[model samples]
Target: MNRRLLGAVAAVVALVLGVGALFLLLPERGQGPAAAPASTTSAPATPTSTTTAPRVLVDGPVGVPTRIEIAELGVDAPVMAVGTTPENAQEVPSSLDATGWWRDGAEPGAPGNAVIVGHTASVDDAVFDPLVDAEVGDEVFVTGSGGTVAFTVERTETVPVADFGDVAADVYRSEGDSGLVLMTCGDWNGNSFESTVIVHAVPTGA
Candidate 1:
């Protein structure tokens, strides 16, 4: 595929797998987070009655994400907006301590999927290393200039690089309720990551 098309696909796939060539150069630390044990099905589970709280709605205009926090994982990091690179790859944060939010995608607590990508590991500890320990029902809080939106971990999936294009379509879909997608490289195989780990979340009133 052409670079532009590939980049677009990368953005979508990154929503789930945080695919990036740079990550390959970094030394391996440990295995990527295993898929949340609760996620057994291939498809994302629809939010059911278990979510008793009303979905948090944007009070006014959606704000750009400024920070992301996962109490369960003890993650508290700054966020920067980023787009695709000239090579047609999704742009990632330069610092391992921060994360990059897809500028063209939905803002948190808005109408569509908001994607955040971070490195799984770097020479020093990376921002998202703790993601490998994430589980369903974990809470992800995204702070914006406007306000904060809370999301509940819905599912996690690990897919091969070759198959990410198909999965990307679903991750980037905009028809559903406001959602969050976290992506990171998964399963290092010496030269490159054999797969990508994707975490799906939905806004919860809390």
Candidate 2:
């Protein structure tokens, strides 16, 4: 999308950076753990309504996602709502075993894109360590208050850090059928990653 559109959605879908231990900029490998890396990607685009019909907000538990499962990759982890940090970047889950959902973005199974993020590596095995191995057609299941929503992976891209902003805008934009996005660090270079792995999926019916 355009720069103006990305700016408009900045408040709702802030970019997620400096997440996980991999993002750290510590000394070369074998020295010690790394420090958090500098921000790389830009904020997301505004999510448009899925339908042209009048919008209606449903009260009560509106299916807040609780867990995410990718059987093909042997990933099953708890999901938690995460908001932006004081600096406006999205916050990741403190626990390495959990994944963070962009709370201000679209809800899973809804019309917009539901963005979920996990660390590739941390103190121990991170929740999305195997995400880079995910392939097209893999099944991703997200369980929430509403129920479970099934998505079929459509594609995967390893985007250079400098180009992440454009890719993120398309992945997180809310102008299409219900969809899902999974993100993590990529291309380890001893000290830090040079790229970001982004997986795009669509609802089973879509």
Give each model's whole-structure lDDT: 0.62, 0.63
Q: Which regions of candidate 2 fall more than 4 Å away from where they truly are?
A: 1-5, 8-62
- Candidate 2 lowest-lDDT run of ten: 7-16
lDDT of 2 by residue, 109-135 (tens): 777788888887633478888999999
Name the 10 consecutive residues with the lowest summed lDDT in model 1.
36-45
lDDT of 1 at 7: 22
lDDT of 1 by residue, 1-206 (tens): 12223222432222223323222111112322212111111221121111122234454324777778899999988787776444334556766677778776688887778888787752346788777678999998887766678889999988776567557656766556788999876776544456678899887653
Instruction: Find the candidate with the highest lDDT and give its number.
Output: 2
How much is the lDDT of residue 124 in candidate 1? 44
Q: How many backbone clashes does candidate 2 have?
A: 5
Q: TM-score of each candidate?
A: 0.71, 0.72
